[model samples]
Target: MTQLKTLFFAVTTAALAGCAATPRKYDDESSRALNLARAGGVYDQDLRDSPDGTRSYRKGLFTTLLDVASLATSFDAPLRHLSGTQTFMFNATDIMATPDNPSARPSLIGWMPGSLAANQDDAYEHYVTVVDEAITHAAESMSITATKLTDVKTPEIDEHPLMLWSVTSERYDCGKSNCIIAYNIQQPTYWKTPSYVTGREAASYNIAANHPEEYSRLIFRQSGDERTFPVGEFYSAVSADMPPWIVMYFPPNTVFQDGEPLTYPVLYEQGQQLMFKEPNHE
Candidate 1:
């Protein structure tokens, strides 16, 4: 009888261990939406047809634990929001010395360019202050605009679809008779690598040679229609540090008018306007 009891206890312990190792289903709509977005869905239909069903697939016990442990560390720093009307001027010196003051040259080191570094540091400090102020102003404007554009009780998720826009660097310009403006619908942020250095080649390689269905590059000619642009010598990868962007060439003498509204179309949303202004100047 003693041996039989011991055997029963061992089997019970093993069964409990197996049960503990199984992951529970995440059935919440938010989790479902997040998973659908991560899987590279471009439209509501794609999300509705996800094979994972309406709930999160059961992960291994170890994998679920690891995800919970890394939650805080995986959070991304939020982007600095600048005002729609604010323009950042390009200053080589300011760019070189930003986020840190240049180290002072040794008093006896006559060969060092200490004064130039000091000047750069000063300019950088001033530029950062200006940028901070602009961000604050922009936030205020955004709040006011949101109030006017949206019903007070409407949730943001219901008002806006799960979509992201690709913001191009203001400095990009090609000398042409007429410049083209393009907007490419991007995969969900979860599908992208966190570091550009590690994933650049894979992201920027020719779409046809890789996951063509996951990416579709669109070009907008001055004629306001979609067209194909030559994918010149393909780059190995995108710069991880840079935001997703679309390149367009403008016609000669076409300057980005200050105070003019910069508009881009929302993917999947037919008649909604996502408008801002060029925040940088040549």
Candidate 2:
């Protein structure tokens, strides 16, 4: 009995000593910041199970670790890089309208003299050219075929305007072992109304108009052995009335960094907190 007690005490002491020997440390301020950023108890909820009947807790943990490592090293570190060719589709829809009654022309409350050149006509024309160039550039850069820009139809001045674009690209590269495809769409504010007339309202309007450009870097990744793994989709309607919409979809098991998989829950949680809120979006 004495020998058994001694053996148990020895084992417990060794375990405690082992735990004390492995001290947790942060290399720098950036590492500490990253740790704090991800440790906000936001991801404490149960992770949604993947289609393969596996939970992605490990993937989430690894992603947090990779984020910390990236911050410690370089902020410009590429989220992902593929050596083989990739394909993407780009589609945009815009509704054009002109006031039929001269007296009922849309009123411009805050039009400045210097910005007159960017009137509705000029804005529409520029939007067309810019979207066209953007699609062409994306296709060329990703080495994929894209559908020609589709101009659906024009509406009357009183009718609500709509602008939406979608892209779908699929290909296998990197020694033909891995396959990847990305789809993204944006629906910008396309209507003019007097509801945004107050100073605060106008300011909010301008910010919402420009939100997409600011939040475009939010990317999600998933991984799978077969290229045909299920794709994950995310969409947001910022406001109920005349709200801007953004949608993105990608295959499962997509990784932003080596060995770090991006999951839907992580992206959705981050996006909901960041994009749809007050201070963050403002």
Q: Model 2, residue 278: what's the lDDT? A: 19
**Predicted structure 1: clash tally:** 10
Residues 163-233, candidate 2, lDDT per residue (tens digit)? 22333446422222122222121222323222212222211111111111111111211223332322222
Instruction: Quote the positional error of residue 37 for candidate 2 in Å.
Output: 18
Q: Name the 10 consecutive residues with the lowest summed lDDT in model 1.
A: 101-110
lDDT of 1 by residue, 191-225 (tens): 12112111122222111101212222222122112
- For model 2 the local lDDT of residue 173 reads 20
Q: Which prediction has the highest TM-score against the true structure?
A: 2
